[model samples]
Target: MSRYSLIRSMFRPARTTPHRCRRDIIMPFPVGRMELIVYAAVVTGLIFAAYHTTLMDYLAYQRDYIAFTTAWPSKPADFKFDMNVFLEHKRNLMEYANLEKSLMQNGTALHELKVAKLYKPLFTDIPKILLDKWVPDIERFEGVEEFLNATNFNGTIAEEFFYLEAPFFQFEHHRMAIMFPTEIKGLLMTIKIGDCYFWSTCHHTELELRDGDMHVLDVLETEDGQWNISRVYYVPAHELLKVRF
Candidate 1:
């Protein structure tokens, strides 16, 4: 071929086969569709995993919150008093009380002051002598009989913790309350504040109180379902020992 003819031939476009072109190439399967389906499946799996993890965490937290808040079985009257549990709670109470006392004596920082203020009411120990008189089979403790005689008490204390199912005003409205059956049959003794906020979160619910609500402090004595509101003494958090009509 002449040089000019060879140059022209080199510049001419090559004839391509219809099926050989990149754009016209057909894969054996639907590659794009397969890729899309795989991507969607992966994304869905990730989303489900995230949702499941979050749901599990939430459920665990709810369980812990409920367990921490509920002091005993649903029915307080049916609860059998376990001395070991009571003593454990008592030790915890004493520890908190001591911590508060130490804070009061030595705490100077703002946080320390706040800590002392926050737990002061929750940590106060109920008088053991009063407990001896109120608690069933409390005479099992040494000196309970002598203390009872010394106080000149004649009325019989209730054998079990009386749970108040309905909300009532005891200083503040208590959605829940447990009373230590006082020797006086138809009298309301004192109701310790039972709010989770007032008692510093769920810590109070874990305590052992007698006449008290969630915390085992001295509370009122009532017939099966009747409350003698006339004699009820409600104590606020700030004024733990002070009597409010």
Candidate 2:
């Protein structure tokens, strides 16, 4: 009530309680057991799925590795790089065994010479200028009359000059005919190559001898300076006759 008593009461310290002085304790947020189990199961399922997928990919890679490692080193037995005439004769000697034998024994040298002389005309020439030059005296050749009479062929050199691979014993070199057939009746004029002559003895299924199908030949030079036909490819008349001159 008094002014002095009121000032003293305001300045005096107040009594403190034990509950107010105590510190507050912190606790974790509550979660259900089912929710915890579901989260654990989802994480385990993801790990299991990843493991199986990785294992499958690894097994596929192993199979490819084995296949690459176990394969054969070289080409198969039936794989042929070239079709050699001599090799074909040796494989199946039906009728021209004797004729082919002569060339295999003695005609190696002559083959080289003929190939060297006719390389430009036979292999590389488009106009065949060198061929006309080389065979300028074709009319005066020894067997020209007999050949012309036998075949009845009356065409110029540019029309019928084509290299062929005959399957029979016609007069020619290396047991293969270098025949010039000018007539449409397939009259083959067997040229004289040394003592051998190309003659049609027998016709096989493989011998696709058309009127103008050209035989493209490749010559191979051996290690011992020997030259021979290395590869033979047949181009049909439709393709060959398309080339002008």
lDDT of each: 0.36, 0.35
Instruction: Please provide, for model 1 over 138-209, each residue's C-alpha lDDT reduced to its tens digit, 9 standing for 90 to 100.
Output: 211233233234333212231112321111212226333433333322211111223212122322323332
Residue 23 in model 2: shift from native, Å? 22
lDDT of 2 by residue, 24-142 (tens): 33323223688668877888999999999999999998897676445423321222223364334334433333443355358665444333433342233223322212111121123
- On lDDT, the candidate that comes out on top is 1
lDDT of 1: 0.36
Which ranges in model 1 have alpha carbons more than 4 Å from their true place? 1-31, 72-245
Q: Return model 1's CA RMSD, one decimal.
A: 17.9
**Model 2 vs. true fold: TM:** 0.22
| RMSD list, candidates in order | 17.9, 25.4
Cα-based lDDT at residue 34, candidate 1 = 84
